[model samples]
Target: MDLINTCFEMCDYIEQNGVVRLAGNVKLRDNLKKELLHFLIYISMTDGRYGEEEKAFIKKKLGFDVSASMAADIKNRNMLGAGYITRVPETFKYFILANAGHKIKNDRYDNKEARTLAETYRKLGQEYLAANTGSTEVEINVLSSYCVMLDENLKSYGLLRPDYKSVAIQAETADEKEPDADELIAELNSLTGLTAVKEDVNALINLLKVQKMREQMGMKQTSVNKHLVFMGNPGTGKTTVARLLARIYKAIGAISKGHLVEVDRSGLVCGYIGQTASKTAEVIESALGGVLFIDEAYTLTNGKGQGDFGQEAVDTLLKGMEDHRDDLVVIVAGYTELMEEFLDSNPGLRSRFNKFINFEDYTAEEEVEILINNCKKQEYMLSRDALEEARRFFTERVANKPEGYANARDVRNYLEKAISNQASRIVGLKDVDKNILAMLEKEDLVGIEL
Candidate 1:
């Protein structure tokens, strides 16, 4: 049945039963009734035809007159947690008046609904009442019990929403914690020392904007950024960017859901024959609405023989990426050379990851900045002379630290330990003063002996 007829039927059922107890045979339908009541009220109030019918319907269904006096007790004046009355809470005063107004405006009625609507508005305050108005088809039954905690008392009571805007009001009440894309990008830029990578990220943002515009215009062409490869050394912020990409995907409605699922070889290839594909496919399903970032993805090709699960994982990954091409974004990260070899193992991999962003090793100057930033992060003091000494030491070390040296990471670790040692030496000097600690000079730099 259409929504209005269905609502009238539910209203009739509730009136005859006095409780509309949604427990047994018609439980699902009863649940549907509870969920869709507010929407029905909205429709009933649209032109005031169904108001008196709704009141009589509600009086029979709920066994109570949904009067203005009762609305005052439930309406939250402070706007702290009042708007949509769901299930049993009679807080939605607007719904009550709108219902009354609709009934009074009916051609079959003898009186006007203005007095009732006006009286309810005066008691509830029109500004406060207006803010809580929402759409007609809101389904409160679908709302989680936790979501309706403010009106938990109504779980057993069939209440009318005095406010017609319950759905929108509840949405506004929900905590909006998702980070804005620009703010996250700015934060990411501040965290990483990779200038070229940041510039590429900015370009990606622009591309997302274009993608968004196309989506808004009802253009359904496949997205331009389906596959991406993050070619970078360890600790270069590849995973961080992938996380932001998930949010960007959500903002543009490219995916039904948006979340970032990060895993490596262990999460994909299980140690069994014919099992790896299913395992990897399951992981992809979980990441359907967001980004799936595979760190050290080269390891997925580590098996020596044809019987290995590694090849199976690789095959599964290739297929899964295609199957979920419309919604999922897969980013594989590893050392640049190894990643190239990995792509070469299966021709499909090479064809799939068409875009790559290489993360170059940090320069000596960048490494120094990384060390200072690390110090600041840990609340350590690095005096000007000490900073210069540390920078010079790292520059010399980088020149001779061998090919596999940890680069910026090693510098950060070394600086962190040096500053920790300095702090330990001065720990007992509680009254030594913050200024003196702040002014710690080159001599204060802990040597290798510490």
Candidate 2:
């Protein structure tokens, strides 16, 4: 292409997704990564063919590879994890510019992505120019224009992204190593719409840190209570944040292990006579040196018959707390009003689980983001029209504020239904491309009312 056309293409991207559109946008960051991969392909597919050698080259350099048939398509549009992108140093703007199943986000995000390509092109283009006597000036213009466009793209990507913030999170894989203290803290920050929870957790961490410092210097330590009361509707990340706190506790030397054990009323209480203490004791023993998260804890005390052994479980649990005061961190969770009543049921309970953190229902935007993230975890995307429908769906859901709404859990269930509809739409199709297979259209949501 001529310099005029080249400049036009470069200028077009600036306008398509400049500062306004690119700022703090997951979609645009993805676009930049896709463009980067395409640029890699542009230079590698010298004869316009994606061969095994080219594929191997990509696999060898990058941490991921694609099937032979998918070499050029699926590999080009892969989305790298946010941890890979945003975990780099401040010097690296940490943009997500490739999805090709490769681990390359720790790479420099400033100008290296463009400059490396430019240099490679310079070498390859020089060879071609030497053979064909092509215009050196044209090559110069091409590299210069690409570099300028890349800088602009990065600038826009950097506009709203300060240093590194959380990317919409996904489930951690089993093989992925556990995150350390700082990493756990970063993960907490990465969770969407947990502003108050994050603040409380940070404050607690800071206080623990200070207390540790004071004790080391032989100063008298202030009274501290790590046991917590988490009051929230279903699926508001009470368990998730509690798990992080457990790991954080271990990382900071507050606990011997960083594991999280979760249970509910049934996990504790028993129907057999005089067996509740033994059952609850086993559960407590398993959670020693870590965090034991109790969900719907109010059931243990609030609506029980006289024959019930819920009181035995409670007495056993309180004794365990006192016995393991140096290690065990108990976190009781349930709805706001019921949890308050649960605390009032026993004087011992009110004294131990004193700190309360409320988990609010997600707003419309956070719910939609959660929906999109859920799709990503399953290797799916939503069409622009579909996304608009989702935004509207969630907005209406939030406005109506449905009774018995399970915040994040509700979003996940809705996505499951949406994808089922997507499957039905594509089931009869003869061929499905990368884009077609991954996308859920607005029609998939049609007649699926709130």
Candidate 3:
């Protein structure tokens, strides 16, 4: 049986044997039971369909079978609506632990099942602590079992044990040192290629710095919108540049935080009405003190007509940009032409995003440099002939580029294939030395088409 089925069986045993009883008031007990049932049903439905086994298990455990209509209502109410459980309250948490403990006893303390149960318990406990602040000392004691279980499970899984004391010391030794504006600019300049893009970013940084200085010197200053549009092809480093822009803004005091929250069309757009706004707002809230990087942003408007919720996502995003203009920088990225069409689709978008940075595709030489960097990162070396072959391969690949040609991403894939070929070549050799093991031969690059 799967984990959820096992949990249901344990719950059934507990209910029939009266091994654990709820100690709360009648209403609280009923609510906790309802929530617990909802959680089980939600978890079971995670695989996309509720089965006969699940229904039978629920009927046997809870003493009542739900009709098809009732089951649909439960799914729509809990999974589709606001009744989906994200946090475990104290009462529901106890119910889970009670059933888990009974399962452990019934299984005669089997280590494997115990370890799996421990992980589930720890996840739920961590969720509770994340959602609540003023937990009582007794409640803390209960949750502390989660950490104990985690440690035990690590050992059970034969993973390298963590050093908590050293971790705590290292965390305490950390300092909140912020990078200066020049430092961030230098970092941006150090990236390979993108000369024009770097120039535009540097100019914007200078403009922001001058504005800040003007404010300090008692001069009139205008409000500047920091929203941006990054137009580029796939693997052209749009996301990477967006990340650096976040740090640049933070260093120049334009934004409060330097973190980057990246999302695509699916992250913001939802299936139902009234949910797209909440979903988009939630993502924006997480990115409040940082940057929200929306990649392939043109896809947000790819829907057929008004039936699509993509427009709702765009409207919510525009509102977020206006409301959090000071601390949040939203960078929408996509292919150059599609991004332009997307901007023109909504006047509000074009008005808010005044700065446009175009990321050009990498040259064949730049692509070779990126491949070499990847090799160095993986501690692999290419023979002289192999290196020449790689350069020729990249030149040809870019010359005969396909529709979805990912510049850097394609290079990485080529390197990965070469590495795999090298592995297949060397895996059977018994007399291989360190140099032989680390080197990629020209033969490794012979059969790669792209």
Candidate 4:
């Protein structure tokens, strides 16, 4: 049967079985039916050639034979101005899947072909929506999945481009809908410390924006390499800054998805020789269209000798960074000296990460501010004396023993200790009120060594 007739039969089945509540307006139902036919035609002609396999599959599943002339006419009419399908009804999607399943039933339901057809229909539905809305505003992660599926299924058969640009249009549209440049800048400025780090990130974001603008204006533009190296002490907000940078990159269309996937050497390197590369690749695969953040990244190179699997992980990671350069951002972070040595260890690493952002340890005042923020979040108010004690403690701790100070992390630990002390001190207070419960006094902050 032809696609239109198959759609009609499916609609009838849906109505008869009460599979979906039909719209009260007869015209609305009719329009949806027409849209379904348009969608099938579009998918059939997407690659510019409707083959015998597709026709035979349709006939076997829909239970009617369709001629080549009829398929060609549908393709031509759709090209002329049949209009694209915007929103596909859930019932119709299920129906298409069910039909595809039926066609493969005699073949023991080849799982691979079923998955390919299912994903093809899924992408077709999304592409139709993107075309109808004149905006490619679909989620980039979803679009990336579609592209992966297309590469696996259609690229092998010469039915789709290996670059997957047709599927990527949806992500580019979503990138266009990113938050405004000024808003993202404002967010960067709103951070508590990391003054130098903020400036570097802002400059990178501005450079990306200009490059994107130039591309839009038909001017020559250079590709911006986004992989970065972060050198800083623990608890100095390297991870926090990396997250914000991911969002900024996405906002400027430098990346598709802005999510941050944080990992360390343990997550990528395996104990076995060949396992490390596969493990690293799996991690990178999950981080496509997003940022892959390797914290304490220097540890990946700590293993000695050529027998170490860490090098295998690094090689795999470098290749992934190169392969997915357009959609992926990699940030390696660790202590200043250690990260430098790690980068020096791998000749390929230094060139790929041209941008470096140094996160400075927070000042005593900044540490106090962090503590205050933590206290506020936990519904605990520091008394004036307690606040003074905290400031004095941090001042002495930072000045006297500055070498291994954990910055904001130390502050958090201090606050947690004080809260514990407060609970211990109040355990005997049966008559405690809200005021006492919410307050952290001087005694609570005293004698807590950094």
Q: Relative to the true structure, how large is the alpha-carbon lDDT of every model?
A: 0.54, 0.64, 0.66, 0.65
**RMSD of each predicted structure:** 20.6, 19.6, 23.4, 18.5
**What alpha-carbon RMSD in Å does predicted model 1 have with respect to the real structure?**
20.6
lDDT of 4 by residue, 1-450 (tens): 433444455455544444345456443236445444444445555444455655554554334365667777876775622233233344444444444334334332232332333334443343333222121222222333332332233333323222212222223465565554334444444455666676566546645654565566565665678899999889998887777677777777788878789999899998897899999999999999889999998888877476778888889999999898899999999999999889988899989987888998788887887787678767899999999999999988877756667888888899989999999999899899999999999999899976
> Per-residue lDDT tens digits of candidate 3, residues 1-450?
544345445444444455455455234335444654554455444444555655665565445576646667887865532333334344434444543444345443232333334334433333332222232333333334323323332332332122111221232333944655544444455455676677667546655654565566575555667888999899988887787788778877898877889999989988998999999999999998889999999998866386988889999999988888788989999999999888887889889988898999899998887777678767788899999998888888788887778999887888889989999999999999989988999999887965
lDDT of 1 by residue, 1-450 (tens): 333344344344433443333335454344433333343343234332333444454454434464433323222241212234233323222223333344323322123222222222122121111122231212112121212232222111222121111222233333855544433443434443555565555445444544455455565423466567888777566776676667656665666666788999889888777788899989998999788899999888866476678888888888888888888888899998889888988899988888787777677777776666666555566788988877777777667766556666676567656766667777787688766665545765546421
- What lDDT is obtained when candidate 1 is compared to the true structure? 0.54
Model 4: lowest-lDDT 10 consecutive positions: 132-141
Predicted model with the maximum lDDT: 3
Give the TM-score (vs. native) of candidate 4: 0.59
TM-score of 2: 0.63
After superposition, candidate 1 runs with Cα above 4 Å error: 1-176, 219-222, 256-258, 304-306, 401-403, 430-450
State every prediction's TM-score relative to the real structure. Answer: 0.55, 0.63, 0.60, 0.59
Residue pairs clashing in model 4 are 1-64, 1-65
Name the lDDT of candidate 3: 0.66
lDDT of 2 by residue, 17-93 (tens): 33224446444334433444444344333333555644554554333474556654643454322222222211112
Order of models, best lDDT first: 3, 4, 2, 1
lDDT for position 57 in model 1:
48
Give the higher-TM-score candidate: 2 or 3: 2
